[model samples]
Target: MNLTLKIWRQKGPQDKGKMVEYKVTDISEHMSFLEMMDVLNEQLTNKGGEPVAFDHDCREGICGMCSMYINGEAHGPDRGVTTCQLHMRMFKDGDTITIEPFRAKAFPVIKDLVVDRSSFDRIQQAGGFISVNTSGNTQDANAIPIDKHAADEAMDAATCIGCGACVASCKNSSAMLFVGAKVSQYALLPQGQIEATDRVKNMVAQMDLEGFGNCTNTGACEVECPKGISLENIARMNREFFSASIKG
Candidate 1:
């Protein structure tokens, strides 16, 4: 298939970026979106042009590094998959694909489709972990019995890959869903109970400090999330926060 791609190009953080058009031919339908991009970059390199810079580590979709806003969607037109998992079959032969970086105040454009996502790391660092003794003396985690339902929910919430799709898809670019998922994964287990109060408070504070907007409550985040993290996690986080405030 022959395709026209209008991709965003920025030389540096302070550079003014714009969409540059390029075309590729003989693209296979089974080729992953990133693979198609590799083709484009190869074409550019062969013609004495600079390759388009995009973030991609594990093309297997687990690393969450393949971030792109394709045709106005977070990870192209596909559902429940990252850009690395997206395939060329989703587009027609004559399609014009518009690829850009995930847009959010906290995620400033670094270069092309790469954006600064260290804000997520900062939020996680705030309080996303449990206080546990992990020296030579380690107790079996299974010793503490957990409710089956809570265990399942916690495991599910823990699947979040910190992809900014939730933030990019949200109208207000809220990190509530991401924060809620992180909080729920810990809050549902007994090991996390010790820091429950401080965890939620600090994580939420850090999320706000990173310039993420308020939750729009439109449920766009869940829709765009690759892991299908439930909105119930957000509600649970709210309850945890309220309970923590009351206890204080």
Candidate 2:
């Protein structure tokens, strides 16, 4: 297959950026999106032109580092799939593909298609963890009898890989889905309830300070999420936050 790629290029956050076009020919449909980009970059490098810069690790879709906006979609036209897992077969021959970095105020561009996502780490640091003593083996695996339903829900919430697709897909650039997933992961676990009140308060406060928008129930985030994390998590988070606010 052949493709025309219109990709965003920028030297840095302060630098002016624009969409630059390039043609890629003879691309295999079996190749992953990142692999297709690799072919394009190889051709550009051979021509003495600077190659496009994008992030990718563990291309099997586990790492959540392959971030890109393709053809105006967060991770291309596919649902519940990340860029790294996106196959070239999804596009037809002679297709014009537009690729851009994840856009958000909190995720400023570093260069080309790469954006800094440390804001997510900062949010996690805010209160995404439990303060358990690591001094010794204190509890057995079954010490806390977690309900099967809660355990399953917690595991589903924990599947979030922090890819930032939620923010990119949201018109408001809200991180509510990401934050909600974190909140739900802990809210359902017995070990996490110890500091649930403070956890919700601190994390939500930090999310606000990071300039992320409020959830507007547009459901774009849920649709674009590679993990299919539901808006129900956001609902759960709202409840947790309200309860935390009242208790505190």
Candidate 3:
């Protein structure tokens, strides 16, 4: 198949960027989106031109590194899948694809199709872990029994891979879905209860400090999230935040 790709090109974070067009031919429908990109990069290199720069690792879609805004949709036209999992068959010959990095004030572009997502790391660092003393006499987590329903929900929330699609899809650029998932993963379980109050407050504070916008309940983030993280998690987080505030 032949296709035209208009990809965002920026030499660096401070460099002026624009959409640059290129054409690729004979792309197989079975090729994953990143494979098609590899083909394009090869063509560009053969012509002594700089290739497009995009992020990808563990192309099986586990890493969430293959984040892309394709034709105005996060992770392209697919549902419940990352860009690396997107296949060529989703489009046809003569298709014009517009590819860009996830856009948000918190997710500043570093180069073509790549953004500095260390902001996510910083947010996670704020308070995304359980402080368990696993030293000498520490009890194993299995010793505690948990309700099956709560465990299931917590597992669902933990599926979040920290991909910024939630932020990219939000008109307000909110990180609530991502933050909600992180908070809920622990809020549902007993192990996470010890620091529950502090965890919610600190994570929310860091989220606001990172320039992410407030959630307007538009629910675009859930629609675009590759992991199917539910909006219910946001509601749970709001409750958690309120309860934590009340206690203090």
Candidate 4:
């Protein structure tokens, strides 16, 4: 396929940026989106032009590092798929693709298509883990005997891969879906119950401190999430937060 790519370019966080256009020819339909970028970069490098910079690791889509806004959509037009998993075939010949980094105040661009997502790490650190002791031989996995329904719900919530697509797609740049997923993952599990009150309180507080906006129920985050993380998780988070607030 022949394509025109309008990609954002910036030297640093503070540098002014703009969209620069490039043309690519004879791209394979089977090529992953990043691979297509690789081809574009190679051509630019050979022409003595600076190559475009983007982030990717584990191109298989497990890493969630291939963060790109393609044609005004997070991760292109596909639902429940990340940028790394997007394929060239999704576009046709002569398609003009506009690529930009994930846009959010909390995710300021470092350069080109990379953004600093350490805000997510800080939110996770707030209370995304269990605090139980496991110093000795761990108890059998079956010993806890979590209810099947609860276990399934928790597993679904735990599938969140920490991708910032939720923030990227939100009109308010909310991290509610991501935070909700984390909270729901533990809220349904026995091990997570002990600190449930403190967990919700601290994580929500940290999320706010990170400059993420409040959820407006536009449902954009759930739509763009590569994991198909549910809006129900956000509802669950509301319940958890309200319950915790009252207790506190």
Q: Per-residue lDDT tens digits of candidate 4, residues 174-246?
A: 9999999999999998889998999999999999999999889999999999999999999999999999999
TM-score quality measure for candidate 3: 0.98
Candidate 3, residue 17: lDDT = 99
Indicate the worst ten consecutive residues by lDDT in candidate 2. Answer: 132-141
Tens-digit per-residue lDDT, 1-248, candidate 3: 99999999999999989999999999999999999999999999999999999999999868878898999999999999999999999999999999989999999999999998888888889999998677888997789999999999999999999889999999999999999999999999999999999999999999999999999999999999999999999999999999999999
TM-score of every model? 0.98, 0.98, 0.98, 0.98
**Off by more than 4 A, model 3:** none
Tell me the tens digit of each residue's lDDT in model 1 across 1-248: 99999999999999999999999999999999999999999999999999999999988878878889999889888889999999999999899999999999999999988999999999999999987788979899999999999999999999999988999989998999999999999999999999999999999999999999998689988988888988999999999999998998
1-248: candidate 2 lDDT, tens digit per residue: 98999999997889999999999999999999999999999999999999999999899888889899999889899888999999999999999999999999999999999989899999999999998777896677588899999999999999999999999999999999999999999999999999999988999999999999877899999999999999999999999999999997
The TM-score, computed over Cα atoms with residue i paired to residue i, of candidate 1 is 0.98
* Model 1 misplaced regions, further than 4 Å: none
RMSD of every prediction: 0.8, 0.8, 0.8, 0.9
lDDT of 4: 0.93
Off by over 4 Å in 2: none
Candidate 3: worst 10 consecutive residues by lDDT? 132-141
- Global Cα lDDT for candidate 3: 0.94
